[model samples]
Target chain A: MFFFKLPFLNLLRHYGRTSLSLVSIILGVLVIILGRGTITGLRESVIRGEIDGMTGHVSVLPADYPTSGLLHPLDGLYSLPPAAEQWLHANAVAWTRRLFFAPRLVSGIDAIRVRAIAFDPATDADVFPRRDWRVEGRIPETAGDGVLLSRGIARTLSVQPGDMVVLETRTVAGAMNALQMPVAGIVSTGNPAIDSIILFLPLSAGEDLLRTDGAISHVSLLLGRRTDADAAAQQLQELLGEAVQTTTWEKEAAPGLEAQDLRQRFLDILVVALLVMAAAGIANTVLMAAYERIREVGTLRAMGLTRRGVAGLFMAEGFVMGLIGSLIGAMLGAWLTFKYSIEGIDMTALVEEMGSGEMFQDIPFSSMLYFGFSGRTILLAIAVGMIVATISSLYPAMIAARKEPADAVRS
Target chain B: MKICEVESVCKIYGRGAAEVRALDDVSLVFEPGEFTVISGPSGSGKTTLLNMVGCLDTPTSGRVVLEGKDVSTLGERALAHVRAKRIGFIFQSFNLVPVLSALENVETALHLARFSGNRRKTAAEMLDAVGLRDQMRRRPTQLSGGQQQRIAVARALVKHPGLVIADEPTANLDSKTGTQILDVMRQMNESFGVTFLFSTHDPRVMERARRIVSLHDGRIAEDRTREKPSAAGEVALTSDASNESNA
Candidate 1:
């Protein structure tokens, strides 16, 4: 119908003005797409890093273990009973025991305080696969007395593999002790949190150094599939009894995810702000078009177009503009998401450049950040763009509709 | 039957100190097939009276009856219906929608009038009548002022309205182009028998009128009938009523 086609022609005739409105809508859609991508990507990356580097699919810790801060209390360390250990080995797909402690490493006169992870070298690799590890020397193996120093701590202490470093810490009995150990390898795992302030030691060495006999801080388990974690943890909890508490990776990662939620809230605010700005731009465009075409309104009315028809004309123009701009922006945003989700954004380089990788050690963080997006996100962007534009044009459309047919006589 | 009747119509603009009585108790009648010109100097109520008959505005007091119905009391919606189906307009500026081609401009009028018969064919034939058939696809901006005005004339006549109101339709054209426009309008009027009411100060337009209604100081000063333009280039006055009168 001519009524439907008229609005498009009207926009085409005034393309310069239409293009300005389109640009604003495009920017607003882009913000939405990128904002969602960033939030989803960050959340996924945190979960991935935690599952691979710290918690396996599930973890069994002492019932009263401290869940916050860098300094974990060593007194809570408990040795797995023979029955519990045998049941875990039989039931779990893969299992490993680990000890976490804070120690000060001294190389020559330089020293830095850091978190150290002691692992069962033989079974640790099965549960926690370390992919993309860059090391100068080889990692410590089963029963190996040598420690693997992270690249950042090694640099700070001015030490390399084959050098002896003294680790000073307190025993469970509250006695200060120091142990001299050989640095077997200096590694950069591409995880800023681990690389910057962590060191790896064999569990045997950790038991001997801390004089805790064979006790460990926790036992991490890997299930057949990620979805099996909750059931496996519940089963493990019944077997392990009340002395130990079984928790899934999701539960362990909750605190870090809260920070991500805060970021999501900020992104939500930003999305609103951007959309409002785009809507304002659309409103201004419609208003200016109405003002510029006053005589055209008069002529249209004189031609017997109802007031509603004139209003529909302007609203249709806005809707078309929003539809176009949002589609383009969504596609561009989606392309960027696909590219980064597969290739990943290199947070290692970013952290290294800023020299702030150590600050990330307190939370589950990864060096490669991947973005997230979906078809629903694109659809939502388009709908939002159209709705905002239509609403914004409402007032201007009314202003145009109010023109007097007698205005046709005016020059 | 009378095409339009204005019964003591009075139009006031603004309010209080700035109020203006643009048309003061002016009565006029237009017969079917009559090419009538309402001639006046500036501020002489020629346009105001045209507005009332065109259904573009309502009189402050009194009635404007178009095709047997009093339109002055009609609501906006009813007035729009009257304008669309019964009346056509041609402005001094030849106000064709610039975005549409000449053919499309004429087609729009048919569309507005809700013409049921072959709109495109009707529009094209109307353009052919105005001698702009070859340039029907060209936009208004692409055409000369005379051609644009011709297209406007085509648009006005294509809908077969009972009355066509043209306000200074030839004011924007040159003398030669103006005469061509006048010739096209006169030919259309004679062929279709669509009553035309014009408000203009152009002498060339006044010379071709079948009837001339002169306005002075917001009231009709003279209503006269004259013979169609003669081969001798002289207008022969058939009848003259030099006061508020009817044609």
Candidate 2:
């Protein structure tokens, strides 16, 4: 009881300094919780958006397709095994076939390379939701020269529906051919990889361009839970044999994962900077308190508190303050997480404020980014608070403990 | 039996050409239950001598025997332990912990000694003994100088220390309050048989001491003992002999 009493009473004596220290700690922890929580939520949400909207929960391609070349050949396509198709039908909630090709869209002096997906809209709609895809015009009709431009491509090419673009590529006959297509719509897939240089065309159009007879590049499967993606991929690979590679969305969305990792590193630095600044404030408070209470320290030493005991007293005070600050910060952080999770932080406004960049893609629901305060967020905040508070007080406590009794008591 | 003994103690400040001896072979012994005052002018080494005997400092060349154990060569931790367990100190500034109340201030010393009894009760009793029963909850800032000094006395005596050192304790208090504080210490000395050593320049304070040792140039010039002061310790103000002694 006295162990707590000594520090508690001492804290009451200098309430101002104690409060200042607590505020610094609380603010630091609050920032950490919010910052890390937002990032965690955002990264997870984007991954979810990618899986549900474009990449599906899993994708199956030729085993060597990943390393075959930057622009995987249209002719390298493998037909989906009947067993794999049966399993996907049994386990997957939705599925779609896509014909992928790397083609150049040419218009007068402008020509840009793009990864195009030829999809059957009726089935593709079931695999991917338009909620976040956000079409600016209309889906392509099955006939005529029709293509859907990604928002980025539409912006770069400055084209709207009814504008003509020339699609040029090497056909399976080893001859380069070109065809004119009228832009049908502009789409925002939310996944930066898909939006940067992606377009949607009728699978028949791609087949006509590539002369691949009727072969599709890969099949996308959506599952009830994303966590089941890896295990399902493994099951599909075994069922279909090793000739094809079945992969999760994380592998399929490599650039997004890398961007998330980079953002995570940035958040780590931000959290440390916040903690260091707070620690500096705590250290300063303890030092000033030590200087102010030199005589009291002498009295304590003369009274029987060992050098260790004197130091322990300060640490106890800091511990109490840190525990309070972290608890408050955790609650505030949790509230922020829940609040953002519901109402969401508007990414569209944030992107506009930040301006257009390669890092910030034009995903439709980029407008409302939600958040969650996971257990990891609160635990990290608490750890930073406790460690900073305790360590920051140690130097001043030791210095105070070293004060000479005679010098302090003299006058 | 002697409660404390300072044997031929010497203390010097600075080094080489800048050095000046603060104490030159000063020797003093405090008999058990004696109220001894070591009086001197400023810089006469009385405070230095008190510090050594209180075990707050160590002399350059001498032995300090506290409670029959020589603490002259003891390390800092050991000296601190002795200071905590056996010696109590009342400073000129009263030196009560400002954060602690009168009772807690007194309780602090007993706590340092690791006293086995009920700490709060013993502390309250000591405060009451010093006429602060009603003011036990007041902190030093809340109490007047006299009240704070009495609290300091309670802090010093509550641990039942063998030797209690007061260095010019009454210097900051007026004569009336000073006498009141002296009376409390004397009563504790009479009742509990606790030895006390004081370093002061006040003749009025010196007059109340049963033993008066005067110092000159860091050396003892005269040592005298009278019967313990009268019931009215304030009468020391009327004594001309104490005034002329320094002159």
Candidate 2 lDDT over residue span B1-247, tens digit each? 6788778889999999999898888777778988888887888888788878877789999888987899989887788788888888888888777777888888888778889999999999989989999999987899899999999899999989898888888989998999889888888989999988888877766667777787877888777776546644543322335322432
- Note the B-chain TM-score for every model: 0.95, 0.91
Q: Global lDDT for candidate 1?
A: 0.85
lDDT, candidate 1, at A47 = 83
Docking band of candidate 1: medium
The B-chain TM-score of model 2 reads 0.91
**Cα lDDT computed for each candidate against the true fold:** 0.85, 0.78
Q: In each prediction, how many residue pairs overlap at the backbone (N, C-alpha, C within less than 3 A)? A: 0, 0
Native-referenced DockQ of model 1: 0.59
DockQ, per model, reads: 0.59, 0.45
For each candidate in turn, the TM-score is 0.87, 0.80
Candidate 1: residue B244 lDDT (0-100): 48
Clashing residue pairs, backbone N/CA/C < 3 A, model 1 = none
Evaluated at residue A1, the lDDT of candidate 2 is 46
Name the candidate that leads on lDDT.
1
